[model samples]
Target chain A: MRAVPRCVPCVLEIAVNTVERAVPEDRQKEAILAATERVSELYRMEPTPQPPRLGTEAQRTVMKYSEDPDPYREEKRRANERAAAVARELESDLENIEDPEELLKRAAAAAIVGNTIDFAVAGHEFDLDELREEISSAEFAVFDLKPEDLRGARVLYLCDNAGEIALDKLLIEVLVEELECDVVVAVRGGPIVNDATREDAEQVGITEICDVIDTGAEMLGLLATEVSEEFAEELSSADVVISKGQGNFESIPEEPFPDVPVYFLLRAKCEPVAEELGVEVGSNVALRWEPEDENVRRWREIVR
Target chain B: MRAVPRCVPCVLEIAVNTVERAVPEDRQKEAILAATERVSELYRMEPTPQPPRLGTEAQRTVMKYSEDPDPYREEKRRANERAAAVARELESDLENIEDPEELLKRAAAAAIVGNTIDFAVAGHEFDLDELREEISSAEFAVFDLKPEDLRGARVLYLCDNAGEIALDKLLIEVLVEELECDVVVAVRGGPIVNDATREDAEQVGITEICDVIDTGAEMLGLLATEVSEEFAEELSSADVVISKGQGNFESIPEEPFPDVPVYFLLRAKCEPVAEELGVEVGSNVALRWEPEDENVRRWREIVR
Candidate 1:
């Protein structure tokens, strides 16, 4: 997606958030400026209606001025612990549910809920209790693909954030043990925002249950060129891909993966993403698409 | 005052609000781009810490693309009616109070509340009842100026918005009749956002109370060069000046009036303003500064 007018402020805001995390108060202004200076340049270079690449750019800029290489280390650790505690409490109850589809959708909703509560985000902080409440009520606009699609098939679960990965682990458990699918979880190559790393996978014990790999995209999204051969092979071999949150929703455009059944389980967190999908903000979206799947097009035709 | 990085999103957000009100949905994109293009130019032309010039610029860009010249007219009228009804209810009880200082501060706070709750603003639409509730809890950071400052003095009240000036009536009542001060109220010469115009002043019954004049600033502040000699004279001759909101705070620099005691009765609505003043968001600030007021300087020194 390319840049929109709304994105500038958001980019600057993200820059402020990233910078504040990295540097002292006095040094934050310069980092923010460094990020702000990149806004027009990125918009000019890229197309309109993009994800939070400005955030990635700002994070990169902030790294230059930062004292700590991974400023979100504490936040990531804390988010994982808190989110894991919630998951640990809920796992038994979720596992006990008889209907498998209900269980999967609920897990997807939990992932969406996790996407909204960003402690690192400026002006967008909310509590875990609120997230729990939001999760319970969230209805997806698209959740057409069933558990049968992934049953006994190779599933690739692309993780979003650190704290969120703990919740994603609950969803992964359902796929691995219940559906009998061979699952591989792919995290980011390096530290960028709160996107999970291989270290987070180890801490969250995601590595213990299933094989975990890292897409070497230093940014939030997965690019084939940026990933290791092992990651690319896993991605290409997977029958069904569940990409959690907005970052993967941004990077992995559907046209490129036409043959792969790509299911996006995310909340439409920003305006551009929401507008592109023609959904309202805070929309619990579980968009599903493959070369043969026609539910989205059929829905559009019905609407038109 | 100049532009800050934080202002980019705010300007775009304001542009979105302004354009959505005036034009059809399709035209909003173009108008928003027009406003965004002006951001770099504005910051380059102006300085780093400006107030709501974004509103002014957005309105101008929207006018270029909009069918309606003043999209905020209906909102302005409704706001004036709602605020006036509230004012009418409070006037008798407020006037019955014997303590002059208590009465003035309450009125000032009411005006600050008015500066917020813009009907034309996208995410900030609030009910009058909500405004009344907010006013009840609102406290001042600085309200040290005594009633003696206005006693038998020529007081100039520079108005901000349409509905807000109606609330300003409560404070003007204290200044004109109770304090026995000569009062002159100046509004905007033309339509811009909801900035009070001569028509709004007349509609809200400013003509019935005191002399009402117009400044040609078009943007919400008083620029001596933009107004007639009559306005310049009224501004210069006033013994005490009460600037209603942030627009004036942005426009009226202290260097121009070294001798004048300018009392800014406002809410630090934006982050930039909040940070500069070292106050929290939604701070009801009644900041006072004269030729040599040293509290602000001393406080800055203490902070540094």
Candidate 2:
């Protein structure tokens, strides 16, 4: 979705959160304001970018000013370790679930729970109890597309934040073993925010499961124009794509996705995203937004 | 009192609110971002200025980019009209009280209630019921100082927002008619945010009640060095100075304040101001921060 004026402040907020991790408290504001100066120049340009893209620019600018290359490296490592311990506990719990669809839905919720590791998006507060509540109570808005929908389907699974990818492995396992789909999980090429990369994928043992590849992206998610030819080919050839978080929800091209049934699995975290999706803030959803979906049909009619 | 990192986001919020009223919805974000770019440059300077100063710069930058001076002109007029009506209602409610001290405290509460007219500080929601609740329910943190504090003493009442000055007239009436102090109300020289100017003071009938003068400041409040010589003289010579809003509370020099007790009457709206003052957010305060006061003494001891 295009940015509104409220998005400008959030850009600076993300910058402050990034710079604070790298610099002393005294220098944090200075570094953030410097980054703000750079990110703001893009505001005048046509075709406004999404929050994650603007956030990526903000993070880059802070890195340049504060001279800290990988500010979130330590935090990401800690988060992955924590996520692994929880993932193991969850893996045992999934063993009792007989239904494959139930297991897949639970696993999808686990992946959404993992998306909260994003420092640039959600602030640095993680409550496992709240996560448990959300997992138990949160219902997917559109979960009607059955496992039969993925019969012999080429599934491209998009990953978001770092530690969260450990949980995503459970969903990927369900996709491959139960749904019987050939799944390829795509991670980011570079370290930006807390988004996972090839190294993180290897660390989390995601490389051991299905085919794993990096999008060669320098930012949080894959913009259609910026990804490598291999990644683009994987995207186009996929029969069903599962988008992970708000980063992918925002970064994916608005025009090209109707042919492929892209199932967006995310929690609507911010106002703009929530408003665009016609959901309340803090909504957990496995939204099916194909060209044929009722909402997308309305969107097409409105656009026309 | 100092600008914290969270204050960074608020600066843009105020800018967005200001620019959106003047420009079309499409251009609002661009105008606010342009303003943010200019405001961020000021962060590199030392003895970092308060939020009001940065806010002044943001508003100035928006005006320059949007090519509209005094964007808040209509809002200010509306606020003044609303404030005048409220002042009339409050004036009658306060008439029943015979004791000057009781009346003055009520007037002080009225003044504090009026301070919410500021779009730069308070978000754009004006509910008369809420204002009435605040006026009645709010108690002074430091209400011990009697009208005797201004007895035979020159009083300088530093005005904040435009519409709020009508309420300031009530307090000035108490000072002049009861306390018998020569009172001067200082306002801004030029339009910045909704900060009161000489014109607003006159429009709100403050000039008819007490002496009204401009500080010759283009910003919200006076920096000691930035004000006119006359304003500086008035500031230095005033026996009991009543400063309105967080803008004045923050703009006042941290040191050199013990010589004359400056009564800071404001709501601790934002986190930084609340944190610095050791008060809860949304606390209505008649805070007297004399260097000799027990709290100030402890603060100095702890600071040292």
Candidate 3:
């Protein structure tokens, strides 16, 4: 989504957090100020500042000043460890579910609850201890697709943050085993904020579940022009795309895949995203962007 | 208080709100963009961006772009009306108290609770209906002076927002009639945000209660150097200065009124102010800034 005036502070906060994490104690202030300046420069220069783009640029500024390619390396490690433990505890619960659709919803809810692990979004507070309760009580503000919609389909799962990916593993397992879908998980080509990388997915055992690919860009959202041809080809050819979080959901254009059924599974963590989805902030959202009628018709024909 | 990274969004939100209120619908985007640019400029230029200072400058940028002197004129008028109604409803409760100390605390709490009317502070939400309940429950987080301390002394009451000034009227009455303190209520000389002006004080009947003066400048917080000489003199000569709201508390230097006891009567609405006062955010604060020991000694001598 395009940046609103409110995004200015949120983006600055992301910059400040990234800078503080990247730079030494003595140089943090200088780096933070410089990153803030970069945010200003982008807002001035761009006709419409895209929040994710601004955040990515600000993160770039912090990296440049600190001379650290991966500022969130340690943070990602910690998040992964925490999420892995939670996922381990949740595995038995998933195993107990009999019906495929019920198991799919349960796992999807867990995945959306896990999106709260995102540190890039401003003012988002996640309590890992409350995960089970949140998942159990989770209701989709928008549920456009059923588990049967993706049955035996080629599903491309887009990953968001490090800790969130551990729970995404649960969803991936459900899609592969319960729904009988072929899944290819895509992580960020490089680190930008706390977005999951290939290493993060591997650390969380996602590589063992299915094929893993990179977006071939270290940006906030997926820009069509910025990704690798292979990834672009995969995006277009996949029968359904399970977008994991706000970044991927935002980056994907309205009509990027006209014939593809993309399921956005995330918690509407901020006002803009919430507004865009027609849901309350903090609501668990599972939406399918209305694609061209021909695509829906084609998908139904295949299902029949 | 020096602005932290968190203040960036807050200051930007203020600018956006101000510009939206001031400028035409067609020109709002242009004005907002320009105001954001100004906020960025100040952050880049100033060694430490004071949020109130940044806010004032951002408002100035909005005024310049919109070509309107007072963007909050209508908002202030509405706030005054709302606050006045609540004050009228609260007058009997304030008047019913027999013990002078209890009455003073009640009036002070009402005044502090009324401070929730401020619109400039980002994320501050106040309900006019809840005023009475809040006043009843309000407890000072850092009350250094007793009601007896201001007895028969010169008290310069610095007013904050428009609606809040009406409640300050109640506190002023208690100070005058109960404590027998000589009171002078000071407001901003020019329009800035929703901060009280001479007109607002008069509209709220603060003029009828006691002597009303102006700070002789348009700015956020009271920068001693920027205010008129008359205000500076009043500030220095007063036996006890009763400062109101976050802006005034932020602007007043740690040791500015070293020879006089300055009672900062405000709601610690923001994190910076809460940290400065060592209280939780949203706490009612009636702190006597610890002045030099000589001032306290002399005040006790006078009391004896």
lDDT of each: 0.72, 0.74, 0.78
In order, the TM-score of chain B in each prediction is 0.86, 0.85, 0.87
Best-performing candidate as measured by lDDT: 3
The lowest-lDDT stretch of 10 consecutive residues in candidate 3 chain A is: A295-304
- What DockQ does model 3 achieve? 0.42
Comparison by lDDT, 1 against 3, better one: 3
- Single out the weakest 10-residue window by summed lDDT for candidate 1 chain A: A295-304
Candidate ordering by TM-score (highest first): 1, 3, 2
**DockQ numbers for every candidate?**
0.36, 0.51, 0.42
Write the number of the candidate with greater DockQ, choosing between 1 and 2: 2
Off by over 4 Å in 3: A20-26, A46-49, A67-103, A117-137, A228-233, A254-261, A278-283, A290-304, B45-49, B67-103, B116-141, B199-203, B228-233, B254-261, B278-284, B290-304
Largest DockQ belongs to which candidate? Answer: 2
Candidate 3, B215-262: lDDT as tens digits: 888887775546677776787689988989888777665223436767
Best by TM-score: 1
Per-residue C-alpha lDDT of model 2 across residues A45-110, encoded as one tens digit per residue: 668766666777877777776656677777777777778777787787677788877787888888
lDDT, residue A134, model 3: 78
> Which scores greater on lDDT, model 2 or model 3?
3
Q: What is the DockQ of candidate 1?
A: 0.36
The digit string of per-residue lDDT tens for model 2 on B104-219 reads 78889899878855533335667777776777666865565477677767988988887887888888888887788899989887888788888888888888887887777677
Better of 1 and 3 by TM-score: 1
